[model samples]
Target: MTRTTTVRIAMNGVTGRMGYRQHLLRSILALRDQGGLDLGDGTVLWPEPVLLGRREHALREIAERHGLEHVSTDLDAVLADPDVDIYFDAQVTAAREEAVRKAIAAGKHVYTEKPTATGLDGALALARLAREKGVRHGVVQDKLFLPGLLKLKRLIDGGFFGRILSVRGEFGYWVFEGDWQQAQRPSWNYRAEDGGGIVVDMFPHWEYVLHELFGRVTSVQALTATHVPRRWDEHGKPYTATADDAAYGIFELDGGAVAQINSSWAVRVHRDELVEFQVDGTQGSAVAGLRECRVQHRSATPKPVWNPDLPATERFRDQWQRVPDNGEFDNGFKAQWELFLRHVYAGAPYRWDLLAGARGVQLAELGLKSAAEGRRLAVPEIAL
Candidate 1:
């Protein structure tokens, strides 16, 4: 048995929806139970998450339920502690930047959720601050670690997509109208005042996905809408929906491949998965969702004549073959957390840094800009 090295983290947002469920309960605590991650040199890494929040009772309850002994309502006091190895932020999108800046000042390694800041400049500032302070910083890019995407990556690497042509993405489901049924997402997701909108919320994910899977995003043109203007709140109170519920986007990639991504909370699912991408190339095409990936090779490709004169009889759905799951797929959040822990505990390097996070914010910002200005905007590279 190797020695377990403890990495104490001051978790500032453990009381929030994502923080408690994904980071604390699933990632950190689960890692602790699995004997932590092995550090290649007969050593193990143990994550110690100290819950910090505005609500003492909620924080205490989470700590107790999760078998953590440390809980605090005072964030500043907790961050000031020298024992805390890392400062993590999964707080509300509006409240993240200040706490992260404070963590950088305190010389702690930092990890945070996406859209590192509300604006692109603020996100870039955080990147610069981390570099100046010489601290390791990372943001959650959990989707890249998904099993379906991983399989898609394999096909791309294998030249299954010989000369990629275009990419089409469909994401979202019908979030219930609170008048009749409970909404699937939090009410804040539809409010602009609370830093919520479809473009800002979903475009960040699309940016990284397209950039990683295909190539760098050279340009973007988007159209957004606020469908279903009225909605009931958590307390059954009616409120005006201020933010956009849908975003239709076209992105020009590095290789001149055009990617069309449509994200909407108002649309009903008619595709194979809740989120799916169908990539077409000179050789073949593949569609990948969160868990499953399907492919159509050129050899197995189907051809049919289009005619409006007769009734359709082609079963287009049966043409593609299923992609195999090579191995067990762990929770994407947990997988990213493990990699982050390894990077912190050992001297291992991780490519997804604050700079990458800033790019995501840039896409969201530019997507909204394009929507408003009714023009295509170029995505200039941000040098670190």
Candidate 2:
């Protein structure tokens, strides 16, 4: 018989889309359905979740729907519980630092969504406190675990991309201005005062994606714009969109490789996926999306003669070979949650801590500065 141990986790911000769908439904509940996670020695570590939120009614609805017993609107009360072993935060950027600080003070292992704090200093401070308190700490770096990126990482490890040259990424799709149609994203995402802006939102994603897959980002050049000037809020009221809806960035990597990525909420999509990255190297090049990857080798490269008057003969899309998934891939968020749980329970090595999160925040801060100054900016390393 397997020994069972319960780990009480206080989850905040379940009212939000990401927190509800990804963290609660897809990750925690799914883990619960799997009879908890194996500790590799015949011990099954179970999760006991305490849902925390501002709206009691919403929290109660979710709790009742999931058949959960614990639900609370009071954060202080939840943190005061000695039985609660971990605190998981998926709150908005503005409210995250204080809650996380309280959790750390309560001696709970802390895990949170990205941009761990609004700025680099706040992120670094959280890392410092976590270290001082000797608590397990982690920040969600979910993209690293995506199937497309996993395949890309495999290729890099197998020396497929010999002397990688550059990477080009295209991300984003049109988000309706809420006047005509309801905006897909939250209204807070468009208000600069509420920690909105594409630079702050996406540079964190690009930071880890670039640093982990290719090389550390040394410098960044960016231009940001607020294409959709006005939008409707959740209440169907019109408000000026103060945050940038689009950002164009060029990042310089440590090994002289250059990366350019365009992120926008105001553009239309005409690609295989909403987000796609094409990585070029001396040996070959590969394009990867959320779940699929395709590669074009040097030997398979086709030459095209420049003839403006003539129609192109080559079928460009048919040239690249699809990369197969050799193994089953789990949900990225669930995978990271498992890793964080292991890091807390069994002392597994987890590198995507608050410090790594701080680096991401650093990039976002610099990216915004670069766009504002209309000049390139250096990304200094963060130390906790």
Q: What is the C-alpha RMSD of each candidate to the true structure, in Å?
A: 1.2, 0.8
Which digits, one per residue and each the tens of the lDDT, describe model 1 over residues 1-384?
A: 688788899998888788988888889988888988788898988888888889999998887776789988788898789899899999878888899999998899999998899899999999999999999999999889889899999999999999999999999999987988999877888899998898888888888888898999999999999998998888898899999999999999999899999999999999878999999999999999999999998988878888999887877878788999989988899998878877877767897889999999999999999999999999999977
Q: Estimate each model's TM-score.
A: 0.97, 0.99
Worst 10 residues of 1 by lDDT: 339-348
Best by TM-score: 2
Give candidate 2 regions above 4 Å deviation.
none
TM-score of 1: 0.97
What residue pairs clash in candidate 2, if any at all? none
